[model samples]
Target: MSAPSPAPVSTLAPWPYPRWIAHRGAGKLAPENTLAAFRLGAQHGYRMFECDAKLSADGVPFLMHDATLDRTTNAAQVLSTTASNTGGDHPWSALAQLDAGSWHSRTHAGEPLPTLENMARYCIANGFFLNIEIKPTPGAEEKTGQVVGEHAARLWQGQAVLPLFSSFQPEALAGARATAPHIPRALLLDTLRNGWLDLARQLGCVAIVCNHALWDAALVAQVHGAGLRALSYTVNDDWAAQRLIHLETDGIITDRVDFFSPATP
Candidate 1:
């Protein structure tokens, strides 16, 4: 009799492989948060995508990296082009028309900013997971979190494809917890400050996403001790990636999805 085929591999946790993630969709390849960028990442074999989200004035959750539209879009120029587009600050009507992708490349010209709904639809339809960073504009933290959480709840309702919502704003995370209790949330830290674990626990975070440099073996173990997953950001090299793996980190967010040589496929 023919030998039985080897048992199927288990894709279980500490997860199935090393935690290499793509930052801002595929890094600087395609415009960040645009559908094109996500599609490009899939072509490169990425199963997870990360992007920033904030609320428009009308309370629509939309993808954007900056607090203002000046950097990634032609908002300022568009305002200059028409008197009607001019507003005191952050006028939603004017902000909506700015071509968010043109600044990245002429080829991506006229690509409009995408809504959270749009992004959710795309990710779910494509069998991809997401990391939605709740980036509130200055002084909009509580509202931004509540609105985005509600939107995320409605979008991912009754589906298994819930996005991992994250933010540096602790209050935002708390608000998200109140608004969408079912969605998983991560605590984002740019610095390794005292009392961070207290804050993370208070917010009910499932993971702590830090700037990789902020973590060493000790910190990774401490996080795990608290029953929290440890995730690092912007890790783009083999040595750094290996170090994190050795430290037993839960995930690594990287700009170079192309070079992430994980131990397993």
Candidate 2:
């Protein structure tokens, strides 16, 4: 039962338990954001998968991290035909041809960047929960959120696990809220300033996702006080895993999925 409009930030549901989450799908194993990564994460027993989402020039939502296609894709080399398309400026046609998976390995050579709808279909059909980080290109915040949010609303139309939308960009989060208020949102921060909680409250976020180094028990308690969850990202070791658990963080987004638990492998 999807809501016709995005819920007020205050009305979002509490996060489901199990703090261990897979970062960018399977992290270092599979090409991040590809279906392969998600499957690998599932094999590792991760119920939740986190990923970044940005809009292709044609408005398609694809998985990517940097604003430019240079680092991860073959866009810098093979697609030098248009290497100048920085950040969110490239058209979908150009992006679709980039070798998205080859840099990872040959086995994943043909893997193209996945659209939000494609990733959603994979996640839902497999009974997995999602934490989508709205990574908008420099000036594409509103557009990215609207496109991804609309696709998410359509994909999880009747699912029990409402997707968790998170972002460092307030505009992106706000746009997502405006587009699909029913889904939950989390405010991602590297450092917690004095008014951070108030800002999170204004954005209608139900959680705060902080860089692992910045999280502590006091911050966790502060988040809880505001009726929100506190989550951390990029944790890669057992010590940090135990630490987050001890702090009672609601969830952790990590690259080292294998270290967290025993699921498939």
Candidate 3:
């Protein structure tokens, strides 16, 4: 006997992303979600990056983690006091004029917020992988996911490693599935809720990105048992990284790009 055919070798979905992912581009090294940040991450030998994507008021998909620009951009000074503070309420043209880097540091004072198209071009040309988090505004989750999914599919055409889409919203993932079923997706959870695996299966996700604190060896095994990859986010410490490594996690999204050394397999 061949030992029962080695228990049939349960097959998992194909995982195209690298194990080490730079969070929000360079992870606080440069302005997050800007071309400069992506470039910085690459300079640090990072081949994979994670950034947030959302839709502008005019329906253009752009890179922005927050619903409002006031935190990352000079929106308070650029937009009229009466203007809506939400990033989704502004057109890309208006968004383009706001300084997205000054808030971080004076060294990057003039760096502009980059569109998803611009970021995609940069990443594709440089042979980098991307994890696009669909961070939609309230009530706009479905449309934002649809538009971002469509744009991502178009942008990454002919590329070997396709962008992986992830979101905390099931509605957003559902919309993405409707728009571009070919693109791989992941479900992001801050906490492991009841029936989370079922929900991930329903959304057709190839992976589940969880809060770093949530994963252990058993959980990782469970995720693998479900034929899905396990990934953890915002892992900024050595202990966390070591734990994930010990647990055989599939991916680690980190803010410590410089510290972690992406060259590590």
Candidate 4:
């Protein structure tokens, strides 16, 4: 079945992943993309987590969502000498020194940013699955994807389940596919632009993770018809989750690890 052709939804193969995914590790409970958030997510019985991985100045892959460090880490205080607050602006040596968790609350203070290797060890040892979003730095999209893909392959070598890499940038996905074709990839959509489905097909995506509101019965059917699984992100409300369930989408990424039960769905 071609990716753009419609087929029966029943033609779908068994999904290799869990239905529930914790966003940015534990979402708002702890600092985003930190190991502390992953631990909290595990406590909530979440088996899968969605993280943003990007490259540092020295080409090391680390887990951080934004291009800048000011929002989630203490780059302002730690790197005061230089007014630069971008994660990619400094090497991992400097990024590793900042406090990543203190911004969330007093209890989570002093948490350091986790390297992709740090995350891999933690997840592989605990039998957890990660959806690594190739959040590339501007002008370095393909390079970030290549570095992340290479590291993910090496780190998770000989493991049963590899990481599911997803990205909004097609170049990033292409780069990952080039370096590590064996790992599964997904196309993340905030909006369904013209020829978006074709884009997913060209990238050889195993699934489509869209903004939750973008899905409807027709869209779900179209994706399934093309022989791909449908997934959504940042889904927090009960009504929206129920709607996606009604559509029978394959995956749901949520920040509300506290509310959703991963074991149930």
Candidate 5:
């Protein structure tokens, strides 16, 4: 058989996301992946936000970072009557009833989890950019990716800046590419492996979001040379941010939204 065709060139326009993105909305300051966090991030002058999207059992797309709800929500106390440990096992109605914010602090009591559509409307209405990390349930990577991509495409139909999709799973990214090729994608890497650039190219990725320590001047230059942006995540300290800035990285995801001024970067 002939060789498989190479991935098509990315038609994505220039990168529009801000260099500084508030991680999980407002990071540790508020309930992550909740509307409260997003609003707090905005209050701190963040223009771009990064959140995780996964599908419930009923296939409704929602904002949640973990596979299980034990850490972020009172699922155990509230859903004790149910046998579901994973968020994907519950319908949207059940998931909606769980208090997603009370675990963070009493101040955010009763803050419910925000659906992907809820986030989309809020961001679109306020002209905010988003980096949507497709965090799928086990064995459902492709399905989650496709659904989230389709939803994002429809949600941001006429918006100027589409949500940037990123994932550590290649299958998910592939599913996304098949479902909505117009929305830009990025490869998320916690550890740099050999031929990563080739993999990113094969996946038609516009950027590579890496662990903050993985980036340096040469790597940044190499990614730029390959026509893809280089971004680092969870960068909270001044030195790390300064280092990434010095390397001329394209984007920086940070947990310290209140500490780091997005306006400067």
Candidate 6:
């Protein structure tokens, strides 16, 4: 028989992570990036979660999505007399005392921001997977990435699968890579700029996290062809989830933890 073309070498790498991930812990069901949200996600059977991580004035990596604490925390009240209410303007000691959960709802009132170390402990103890998105303050991109990456490396040293580090800022990814070269890193893409693929490769990313709408069959093949996994974020609806599944995208970050069973995915 004609030599069978060496069984097409599989482009897919060994992805140890689960297919489904909970967005900002439990998404809108609970306050984003709070430990309570993670607890609730676990209750709904989610094994993996994605959260935003940024540094405080003292450089402690903690969870919160916005640059200003105004939207998520009672910053206006807590920082009433302070010169600045920006999250990164305060030390973690001060940041921690702010009510992070009350903004979402009264039930989560008094919830404090969980440090990355605190998150590491919970996930490691419960055998959960995490994707930490390095969210840098305006002027602290590289520093935030370095700090978060260093902390993550130290925290999950012996874990089988280290937490994934992802960011839209290339410099942030570069910093993380410098600190924790062994931990897997992914490039977060909101839009396909020129030579995006080349940039991702340059950053040594194992995966590409994109907005759900940006994905299609050709793009999946393109990413796979480059030996990278294609992952989508904020995929909430059933139709979109089905589409990614159909296209064979490697991972899905979603707010609908209850709608999609992680156990089955």
What overall lDDT, based on C-alpha atoms, would model 4 receive against the true structure? 0.92
Q: Once all C-alphas are superposed, what RMSD does model 2 give against the true structure? A: 7.5
Clashes in model 1: which pairs?
Answer: none
In model 1, what is the error at residue 214, expressed in angstroms?
Answer: 1.8
What are the candidates' C-alpha RMSDs? 6.7, 7.5, 1.6, 4.1, 6.6, 1.3
93-174: candidate 1 lDDT, tens digit per residue: 6666879788999989998888888889988888778899999877888888899899999988988658898999988888
TM-score of each: 0.87, 0.90, 0.96, 0.95, 0.94, 0.97
lDDT of each prediction vs. the true structure?
0.80, 0.83, 0.91, 0.92, 0.92, 0.92
lDDT of 3 by residue, 1-265 (tens): 5545556576686677789999999998999999889889988889999999998899999989988888999999989999999999989899889898999999999999899999999989888999999999889999999999899889988888889999999999998898889899999999989999999999999999999999987898889998999999999999999999889899999988889987776
TM-score of 1: 0.87
Question: RMSD in angstroms, candidate 5?
Answer: 6.6
Which pairs clash in model 3?
A: none
Mind giving the per-residue lDDT tens digits that candidate 5 earns over 1-265? 8999997775434778899999999999999999999999999999999999999999999999899989998898888665678999899998999898789899999899889999999999999999999999999999999999889989999888799999999989988998899999999999988888899999999999999999988888788878899899989999999999999888999999989999875
Candidate 4, residues 115-192: lDDT per residue as tens digits? 999999999999999999999989999998888889999999999888899999999999999999999999999999
TM-score of predicted model 6?
0.97
Across 1-265, the per-residue lDDT of candidate 6 in tens digits comes to 8775766778788999999999999978999999999999999999999999999999999998888888998878877675586789899888988888998899999999999999999999999999999999888999988998899989999888899999999999999988999989999999999999999999999999999999999999999999999999989999999999999998999999878898765
Q: What is the TM-score (0 to 1) of candidate 3?
A: 0.96
Off by over 4 Å in 2: 1-14, 80-83, 262-265
